[model samples]
Target chain A: EAGVTQFPSHSVIEKGQTVTLRCDPISGHDNLYWYRRVMGKEIKFLLHFVKESKQDESGMPNNRFLAERTGGTYSTLKVQPAELEDSGVYFCASSQMRTGELFFGEGSRLTVL
Target chain B: ELKVEQNPLFLSMQEGKNYTIYCNYSTTSDRLYWYRQDPGKSLESLFVLLSNGAVKQEGRLMASLDTKARLSTLHITAAVHDLSATYFCAVGSNSGGGADGLTFGKGTHLIIQP
Candidate 1:
């Protein structure tokens, strides 16, 4: 089976611009997660979706960041008025069930200048 | 909040040498995972430790978990240059029936000089 896939492997935009990253989870996987790693920082969780419903979103950094999984299949993370601090690698992962091993995508690298 | 800590934030070893990376978590967890990431690449799963005293090994890498102490270790036996990369350990909480988010450590950067 194909693993999780992310779109626009790399994204570069000016500060104050908007950007959207997409992720397609593995087939039949109900758990999808979003994470990002800033320069010199560890990977941090952003949010989670379980079959179209948000399971957890406490890790969202600010109001400018929004994530949604409309069909519970693919997910999108949008950042409005992106800032320099938003430059980092965004990773998406999916698992068959809660507590199962996660399969990760290649990640989307966002650079804001 | 759950916290994961990794020791020796960076390591440089010679080929044929052996070393171990340690991961310590703040609270109890349903499972622990080890992942490897090469420069500018996404993470690749290495080992999944599901229970206390669980051990798994593949190739030159081995991982073990000690739920009682909330600790996990990744041991590299006879390291090679190809193994140079950053390693991260993640702890999964029991919430959502293991569906909860994971807390990851800062990661260990391993450099093996051949």
Candidate 2:
């Protein structure tokens, strides 16, 4: 079976530019999550989507970061007017069961200059 | 908010030796996970500790969790060159069948020299 896949493995944008990252989870998985590792910090949770619903977005850093999962299939995270601190590796993961092992995608490394 | 700390943040060990990495969390959690990430690679699932005293091992890597102490351990036996990677421990916030974002510890960068 194919694992989770992310788009544009690497992205570069200006400080005020916009960028969007996409994630396609394993087929039939109901739980998808987004996490990030910024600079030298720990990998932090950004948000989670359960099918078409936003399960938890408490970790979203700010309003500039928007995430959408339409039709409960794939998801997208868009950062508008990206900031320098937003440069990091964004990871996407999915699980068939909520508490089961999560399958992760190759992260999208964003570089905001 | 839950806090997870892992130490030592770096480990350099010779092949054929043994070493242990530790993970400690500030809050109570039944779901603990271990993941590995190679340089320029994504995270790979290693172990998931569900309850107190849960133990799981694969190949030369063994992971154990003690819920009472809120501590989890990853033990490497006879380390190999391929074992050099960053290891992370995460605690889940979800209950039942819901998805909750994980709280991860700063990764332990391991180097196994041959």
Query: Native contacts retained by model 1, as a fraction?
Result: 0.68
lDDT tens digits, residue span A1-113, model 2: 88999998999999999999999999999999999999999888888898999988988999999999999999999999899999999999999876799888989999999
CA error at residue A91 for candidate 1, angstroms: 0.6
* Candidate 2 share of real interface contacts: 0.78
| Second chain TM-score for model 1 | 0.95
B1-114 per-residue lDDT for model 2 (tens digits) = 689999999999999999999999988786999999998887999998898888999999999999889899999999999999999999985443443888999999999999
Clashing residue pairs found in predicted model 2: none
Error of 1 at A2 (Å): 2.2
Worst 10 residues of 1 chain A by lDDT: A95-104
> Which regions of candidate 2 fall more than 4 Å away from where they truly are?
B94-99
On the 0 to 100 scale, the lDDT of residue A84 in model 2 is: 98
DockQ score of the complex predicted as candidate 1: 0.64
Model 2 per-residue lDDT at A41: 93
